[model samples]
Target: MRAPCERSERHRSVARRRWISRASWACLMAACLGGAAPPFVSSVSFAQQPGARQAPPPAVVVEKIEVQQVSNPAQFTGRVEAIEAVDIRARVTGFLHSVDFKDGQAVKAGDTLFEIEPDQLNALVASARAQVARADATRISAERSLARNRDLLARRTVSQATVDEVQAAFDVASADVQVAQAALDTAELNLSYAHITAPISGSIGRATFTTGNLVGPDSGSLARIVSLDTVRVAFAVTEGLLVTIRQQQASGGGLDPNTLKLSLRLANGTDYGTPGRIEFIENEIDPQTGTVAARAVFPNPRHILLPGQFVTLYVQEKDAPSLPVVPQTAVLQDREGRFVYLLGKDNIVSQQRIHTGARVGNGWAVTKGLDGGEQVVVEGIQRLAQGMTVQPSQGQPVGGGT
Candidate 1:
């Protein structure tokens, strides 16, 4: 009874409506089972559930602060100096004949360092000897004359005035002989100067004058010698620090120069294995720099330290008092001040402000705001909040057991 074209159109519309209904049912089932609520159900479900709590404070490594005896060393820039340094120079004018020692060689006292031409000096010595011989002959003749005159005067053969004149001539001859002897001694001394010798035992620098060069007393220096067995390190400290040291000494908290320990760090950041002692302190403080100069002596048996080398001098007071110290990593700074997270009785982290002093090895010396026997958070400090509860575990204190 219906037309065939109209029936075909109705069948296609019914099939499309059924397919859409099945797709909507599958989506709803996937959302509910996968724990993903549909947009319309999300707000309703959240309202029905209880409120969520914050995550537990992160687990942190904590350690109890302990007091220990530590030397709070102070570091200052310094320079190495030789115990004895000398500039080798020629004492006479002559042509340089030879250099006895090689450049940068170790030398002992009385070692020949240079040789100057001695031909002229030898001629002078011969001339002086001839003069001495002439003066000696004159003295002999004058003495004989005086003796004969004295005998004649006793025998009444000569007058008193003639004997007196002969005695005066003998005295003049004797004086001439003495003067010639002195001249000969001076010539010999000049000859000795031609062969220059080392004045002290030390390492020698390069020679400034070579063979064939005219060397003289006015020549600045032929070479340099520096004693390296023991070296001195000179450094300057602030006046304020000096005052504090004196005050500590008065209170028995500081050490004397003999008892203090010193160490050096080379420019390349390597430690000098040998230890040194503070041997000298300047008598007056430098007014312009507001500093006091101090010096320490170190034994350099192998000649490891060289003069004029820059280094760092570390001064440590022996027998220093014990103080509360914490790992440097535990300390933190902010707008307020430097502080550390302390774990109290209930495992609550509290930010405790601290006044820090010099570094004691890898730890910080606490000057104030902290007593011994308090847990300090070292690992989880970054995540910590004031008054936050945390689970703390014991860990080794920093600086390897300190």
Candidate 2:
């Protein structure tokens, strides 16, 4: 044998040459057809290949612009007020013998609220009656003397001067009797004032003066009474809103105080089930707040509404015109103003600039840049690009409950 090792080496050399020739042939064939693809093909090129799977368009939730005839209510922080409020005060100077009503009690007109010590008043009345009796006796004696003097003068037993003097005495006694009667009347009237009574029908506040406390007319206020059957709320509105109201009223539009729908939301975020009507609007705008004051009246049968309670007041114009509304989620903001992504035909998304106004429920009242029946993208607006293709689905109703 020539050598086993030499024979094995020759076979390896033959295989390497055969493999090189085959690689060159393949490269030449790829160059003749087109440029050779890289060893690692990019995803972009793979997608461009015929029969390759295509990625679906981005999905978005869209809603049709609703032309709602609902009122675009404006809300403001309001303070509750009593339709009629009164400060209770003592009318007579006296020591309080008893407080008839408890704190925060409901009282009616003519209800006795407090009792004053009446011993001194009773003594004054007795003294006045005694004075009246003494004056009456003096008048009777003077009248008898005047009559006797007149008869004597007629019978020539008395002079005209003596009769005239007796007449003057009778006149003085009569005047004294009248003055005493007036004093007695005054005493009785004061006695009535000792029993303090409520002047209105409403809920009463806590008494400032308890029993044994001296109270008088000069004492500021003993307690307060607020009407519970009906209450009022006062709030401020911007000058622009006030002007619009005035214009509507002047033109006899439907925005008059009588036509407004007033509603209240308590501090605890509960609605005051009963509706209210506008009571009055202030005469002028406040210079400091740049707003005008307005008031509304609501029925408070349960006495839930109280004076000075902070609450939210919503005012809406009845029968307001229809407006295009978009869900709050669909709106986006930039330096120019507010805007929303609108879905046009061919499933294309377009950036639509809009002017927004007051909030209507869970959406914004579209003041401009949109009409009814336009499709607006609510969800998936974050990643959406202008003119991008998207797959749309019906969106959930705005303001709907879960």
Give residue 65's lDDT in candidate 2 (0 to 100): 90
lDDT score of residue 17 within candidate 1: 94
Listed in order, each prediction's TM-score against the native is: 0.75, 0.72
Q: Which candidate wins on TM-score? A: 1
Model 2 per-residue lDDT tens digits across residues 186-277: 99989988988999999899999999999999998999988879888888889998788678778887355666677888988888899898
Question: Which ranges of candidate 1 are over 4 A from the true structure?
Answer: 1-58, 64-69, 243-254, 329-357, 366-375, 380-389, 393-396, 400-402
Pairs that clash in candidate 2? none
Going through the candidates in order, what is the number of backbone clashes in each? Answer: 0, 0
